[model samples]
Target: MRRYVFGRLGQVILTLLIYVTLVYFLLQAMPGDITMMYLSNPKIPQAAREELKKQLGLDQSLFMQYVSYMKNFFRGELGVSFSQYPKPVWDILMEKLPRTFVLFLTANVFSFYVGFVMGKVIAWRRGKVIDYAATVVGITFWTAFYPLLALVVIWIFAYNLKWLPLNQFIDPRLWSAAPFTANQVFGNMVYGAAIIGIGIFFIFYYLLRGLKPSRRSRAQAWALACALIAAVLFVAARKGMLIYIWDITRHMILPVFTLTLINFAGTMLLMRDSMLETVQEDYVMAARAKGLPDKVVRDRYAARTALLPTVTSLVLSLASSMSGGMVTETMFSWPGLGQTLFAAALSNDYPLATGALAFTGIFLLIAHFIADILYAVLDPRITYTGQSGV
Candidate 1:
């Protein structure tokens, strides 16, 4: 288990390293001299311009700059932003990241559980009217363009009815009353803990039941570790944040609804198809023949095996969440990584752009690592050697 985890962690590090190098060098190779762009003053002497270039380290060779940048990066320095002069690139990203994280995190919550349950039901009742209707809706949204759907949602909720805020992530007015308090931060942590706790409990329940001592003990360890962490946070959280949480939820309604609607279709369809296929396997029929309870036959015999593809979809959704909803964020004027990346491009802010892109690559690779961990946790019969435990 230790070796498997270390191996995956190494792969994640390598992937991020390659991504940073590629994004940096590719930006350098792009047309137009950024130094010239920055020195737009026609009256400035060539020597003065050269000095400015030297100051920004644009005069250095790419290799040296890369080495220097990496050394600072390893020490938690993201360098100063070109546009937001004197402010660190890391600081800029951190300001915008939370809003984007909340947007994607909320969307994932709706898409994942709703898709899983709906898919399961539709597959179980295939050929019924509800099934066909769901299939049609799923495929339609799956194929629909995100911007178009987002516009439709905006028109309905923001324009026609005027139900939701048309732009930005928060109602700034709410801050007048409460300000940015530790309460909101702690409230978020508490909510996160509860969610994690429920998920870990199910992992233990599904995989540990009737298992051998070693296998069951591993599941118990995971359960206790997760529970302890969550319990600590839950105990510490302040309920006062719930007041500000209301405002966050209000702003979240439109974009979250739009992105979640767009993402829901594909996950549901894929999960349904996977389940449908798995349920038709010979073992499902054999399990039914052995007089197992219907729920037992469905869950133990069918659902577990059917979950692999859905798990992949889940991980991909999680990775994309880190990228933030580019179109959605833009349309809503949300300050997310998507909007920030666009700003970086326009300003020719390579450090910020590269750092954001690198974070995204790391997010994707970590999501894959998590999926791997989940696979082993959900199915004790799965092994690090890429074989069934049997």
Candidate 2:
């Protein structure tokens, strides 16, 4: 196991290096230099532009520049943004990243839960009305054009019904009187949400792990989890923090809803297919022969085994989501890593753009490493034998 982990870690490092190098060179290969953005203004003198280029180390040979960038990157210095001059690229990303994380993380988690649950039920109840209804709805949403769907959702929920915020991460008017920045509020929200998630997970784990398959015990567990959530919210309200969190959440509803609709269908379909295949396995038939309850047989014997592929897809999706959803962020007027990357690329902010892409690549590599480890844990038959596939 140790050997496998170390091997994967080494591969991650090598892959990250290749990804970063590619991002740097590709950005450099763009049509115009960063200085060209400034030179478009006639008042910016030629000598000043030359001085700026030299200051930015653009005057150096491509190889030298690449070497310097790699050195600085290893040392955790991402340099300054050309567009937002003098502000470090890391700072901009930091400010934007929390928003992206909060939004996509919430969306992905909720979508996965919904997909897994719905898929499990549909798969177990194949050919039933519920299965047909869910499959049709999921497919419909899945096949819809995402941007147009988002617009329609917004138009219905935000514009016509006035049920949610129209766009942007927060309502500026509401936040104007707040003492903290939106980033700070988002950070607090993330921490609060983490606590809530951990608390709920423990409730489900400790309360249901050894319990027999029954509606009563499951109901108790869910009740406790819901109570925990409410308690967290109550505490936040007592501490005068709920208002800020609520504001952000209200703004988040439309995008989260739209994203869930778009993504959950794929997960559901994948889970359903996997579950169908697993149900035909010998162990599942043995479980049925033992006269186990339908739910137990399906969940324990079939669903867990079927979950492997879905888990893999989920991990990759989560990692890719860290890159940010460009269209989603733009459509919602949300400032996130995706929007930042888009703007940086358009403006030729090499440091910011390259850093964003490299950051995403690193996460993807890490996710693959994690997925490999998870495979062994989820299935004992998946053993590490020092092979590349392992």
Candidate 3:
């Protein structure tokens, strides 16, 4: 396990190193430097422009500048933003990271569980009316008009009806005061925790319940119920339940739904194919021929083996979450890294742009590495033979 983890980690570091180098050269190849954007505004004089360029190190050799940038990046110094004077690039990213994380993580969990279960159900009833209907609906919703559907919903509910806030993070009113009191911070944390707990419980409870031993296993049922209740109460104590529910539900609904819809078709189809194939495998046939219960054969032989492919795909889906749906974030006005990166690109803030790119590259590389590790764990038939696993 230690070797596997270290190998993957090494690969991630190397990938990031290559990505950073490529990004630096690519930025260098762009038409103009950050100063040009500011200079074109006509407000600042040429003298001021020259001074600003000097201050920002645009006057230095390209090699020297690149070296300096890399050094600072390694030290977690993302350099100053050309647009936002005196603000470090790292600081901006930190401010936006949490919103993106919450949105993406929620979407991933929803999509994976929903797709996984739906795929199993369809596989169990393959070639039937229900299976065909589900396939059609899933394909249409996921492929034909996922983005448009989300936009329409947001427009109708948030714009036309004015029922939801169109864009932005939490209500500004919540943090307008200077030097927030300890009570306020504590209250906010507690409220946030409670909402997250409640949302998770509601979403995953059915899936967990369905996995219970038997319909008459009241003890197992009660245990799950208690677990759910305890989680909700614990979250409520840390963050008031009312605030938690309001924010999580309001802000999360559209994004989560959109992400789940986008991923549903692919996941469902993959699961269906894998399960169907597994059901025909010689081992599965053997298990069925031995007079085992149908449920036991399906679950133990079919479902277990089918899950290998799904597990790989699921890992990739989870990694893709960090990209955080650019269009969706724009539509919802959710404050996240996607929007921040968009702004950086539009403004030609080289340091900020490259910093965001580096961050994204690092995140993707790490996620891929994790997926590779999971693949090895799930299938002992596969083996890695590299100083750094890929």
Candidate 4:
């Protein structure tokens, strides 16, 4: 395991090195330079333009520039943006990072958990109306384009029905006007405390079940504990913080809904297919022959075996999500890495654009590596064995 892990890490390093090098050279090969952006005014003197180019290090050889860029990257600097209002590229990107991350995290977790559960249940209940309904819905959403799906939801809920807000990341009126009252704060705390109580109950009674601990049960316990903590932080914020969070949540409803819809169908179908296949295996039939109940036969024997592909799908989906939901984010006008990347591209901010792309590549590679590690954990039959597949 250690040998495989170390080998994988070495490969990741080499991959990232090549990725960064390629992105830098590609951006360099693009027409125009930042000096031109700064010298947009026709009256700007030639000597001043030359001085600015020299200052921006545009006058340096490609090899030397690449060396300096790598050094800055190592030092946690992504260089400076050449926007009209110049600032550190990292600072601009960092400002929007959390929003993008939280958006993807919430959507991915929601879609995967709900879809997997629905898939398993429906698959277990195959040949029934529920199964047909779920399959049809999953296929429909899966076939639809993401942006088109988002627009449909927007038109139905936000445009025609008026059930949800549209576009803005926050309700400007509520945030800019009324603030959370003391009663609101206290009430939210009480609400949060109640959730925590429920979480603890589930963790002990439902999860422990007074038996030996298993990975699934332990994971449930931890998930509840983490959810409890997040609920507390989110719900118990003071007057000033509460309003902003509330507004954000309200606005996030549409975008989150759109993302969840996009992710739900494919995963659900995958799980359903995998479970259907696993149920017909010899071991599953043997479990049935051993007088195991239907639920036990399906869950412990079939679903457990079916989980491998679902887990791999989850790893890839989550890794890709870390790059930010560009289409969804764009449609919603959300301030996120996706939007920032678009802005940088339009304005010819090479450093920022390259940095964002590099970050995306790094995320994909790391996620792949993590997925490789997870395969062994999810299935005992999987082993490295210094093989070609991994």
Candidate 5:
């Protein structure tokens, strides 16, 4: 296991190195100088532009610039953004990353848990009315009109109805003022706590319900505990003991639903097919012949084998997710890395663009590495053995 992990980690490092090198050169090859973009304003003199170029090391040969950039990258310097004034590319990413993390992590977790449970139920009840209905609902909800649905909900609830706030992270009023009083801080915490607790319960109920019998009981208990906490917080929030959870949900909900819906059909289909295939396998037939309960056979013999392909699919999906859904983020104005990358590309911000590319590559490499490890874990017959194609 150690050997397999180390080997995959090595490959991940190599992949990232190669990708970063390629992106640096590709960005360098693009027309129009970083300095030229700034100097085009005509306020800066020729000598000042030359000095800036020299300072930025853009005056050097392409090879030298690449070498320097690599050296700096190794030292954890991602270089400065040409488009943004007096800010490093890394700094901009860092500032935006927490928001993206909060949004994407929440959305991914919600989708995976909910989708997995729905898939499991459909798999177990294959060919039944319930299964068919779920299939139709899942496909329709996730694939066809999920984004439109979210839009309509937002329009009705937020814009027309005035029940929720529209677009923006947190309430501006809460953030605009200087140091908050203890009461304000406590109020904010109460509201935030309630919102998160309630959101998690709604999103993860299916996941808890789908766990193995031995695990599901414990998960239910935990869910109950969370419900109690959420209830308490909700009461506090109502009494002004807590501030209203800032209505970031408007900006957050669409992207979350879009991602979930985009991935739902494929996940469900994959699960259905995998389960069917597993049920038909000789081992499953043998288990059934041994007079094992249908549930036991399904869970122990079938689901285990079915998960291998699902893990592989999940790994591949990570690349698309981490690339940052440009169209989705742009349409919703989510202010995620996807939008940032798109903006950089349009403005020809080489440093920011290259940084974004590098980040995407790193995410891909990590996702692939994780998938490789999971593959080994899911199937004992498959061995890494320090060689390719386990």
Candidate 6:
């Protein structure tokens, strides 16, 4: 295990170096620097442009600039944003990353749950009307143009029905009168989520560790878990954080809903195909022959094996939460890492854009490492030696 981990960690470092180099050089290769925006302005003299270029190190050899950037980046410096001048790229990323994480993470979780459940049922009832209907719906949404779908959903829910917020992360009317910044509220939300997650982890760990519980016992266990979550939420309400959270949730509904619609289809299809193959396995037949209930045979036997691929996909997607959704963020006027990267690239803010991409690349590489380790744990058939996994 140690040898395998070390090998993977080494590969991650090398890959990250390549990724950062490519991002920096590619951004430098763009048509013009940030100074291009001032070129047509007659009042900004040529000397001023030269001075600005020198200040930003745009005058240096590309190789030297890359070396300098890599050095600074290794030392935890991501440089300053050229568009939003004097603000560190790290600060901008920190400010926006949580919002992106929350949005995509929520969407991915909802999509995974809904897709997995639907896929399991449809696979079991493959020849039924319900299966065909689900397949048609999933495929239709999965193939639909994402931007158009998002716009239509917004028009129906936000603009016409008046069920949700039109756009932006929060209601300006509500936040403008608040004492604290939105970031503070976001930080509190993170803390509350962490606490609740840890609590749930313990609850499941203890309650489901040994043998199966009776139906009443199982219901009580779930109730206890729900109460634990509600307690955390209650504390947030007492601390006056709930109102802002609700506002953000209201704004989030349309995008999250739209994303879940578009994404769940792929997961569902993947799970369905995997389950179809898994159901014919010898172990599944054995389980059925032992007089086990169909539900238990399907879930405990077929579904668990079929879940491997879905779980891997979900983990990688979760890692990509840092990258954010460019169209989703932009259409909704949600200021996040995605929108930040989009604006930076358009404005030729090389530092900010490269930083954003590099940050995302790092997360993706780490997620790959985590997924590889998870494969061994999830399947006894797979083994990792000092060499490649088998």
TM-scores of the models, in the order given: 0.84, 0.89, 0.81, 0.80, 0.75, 0.92
Error of 1 at 7 (Å): 2.0
Name the regions of candidate 5 deviating beyond 4 angstroms.
36-48, 130-153, 161-163, 177-251, 285-297, 382-389
| Tens-digit lDDT string for candidate 5 (1-390) | 677788768878787789999998887777877676765688888999999889877788989888888888878798888779579999887665555555665566666666666666678778999788978877776556545665765587668977655555556675565255433443454356557666765555544335445666657767776777777667656655444333454446656766776676666677778888888899989989999888778877787678777767676666666764665565566676778888887777877888888877876777788677657655767778765555
Candidate ranking (TM-score, best to worst) = 6, 2, 1, 3, 4, 5
RMSD of each: 4.7, 2.9, 5.0, 5.7, 6.1, 2.4
Model 1 agreement with the true structure over 255-282: per-residue lDDT tens digits: 8887777788777888889999999999
Clashes of 1: 0
Looking at model 5, report the run of 10 residues with the lowest lDDT sum: 178-187
| C-alpha lDDT of all candidate models, in order | 0.76, 0.86, 0.73, 0.77, 0.70, 0.86
Stretches of candidate 6 off by over 4 Å are 205-221, 316-324, 383-390
Candidate structures ordered by lDDT, highest first: 2, 6, 4, 1, 3, 5
Worst 10 residues of 4 by lDDT: 181-190
The top-ranked prediction according to TM-score is 6
- Between candidates 1 and 3, the lDDT winner: 1
Candidate 4 global TM-score:
0.80
What range of 10 consecutive residues in model 3 has the weakest lDDT sum? Answer: 177-186
Candidate 4, position 238, lDDT: 39
1-390, model 3: which lDDT tens digit per residue? Answer: 667678668778887878898998887787877778876688889998889889989999989998998888888888988888689888877666656666776787788778878888899889999899989988888775655787887788778998776656555564354254323443454455556566655554544435444546546555666776677657555654445445545767777877888887778889899999988899988988999788778876788678878877776776666664667688777767788778877777888878878877876776677677656655566677554444
Per model, state how many residue pairs clash.
0, 0, 6, 0, 3, 0
Clashing pairs in 5: 142-261, 187-242, 187-243
For candidate 6, the per-residue lDDT at 318 reads 68
Measured by C-alpha RMSD in angstroms, how accurate is candidate 1? 4.7
How far in Å is the alpha carbon of 1 misplaced in model 5?
A: 1.8
Q: Which residue segments of model 3 deviate by more than 4 Å? A: 145-147, 157-165, 172-242, 290-293, 319-321, 380-390
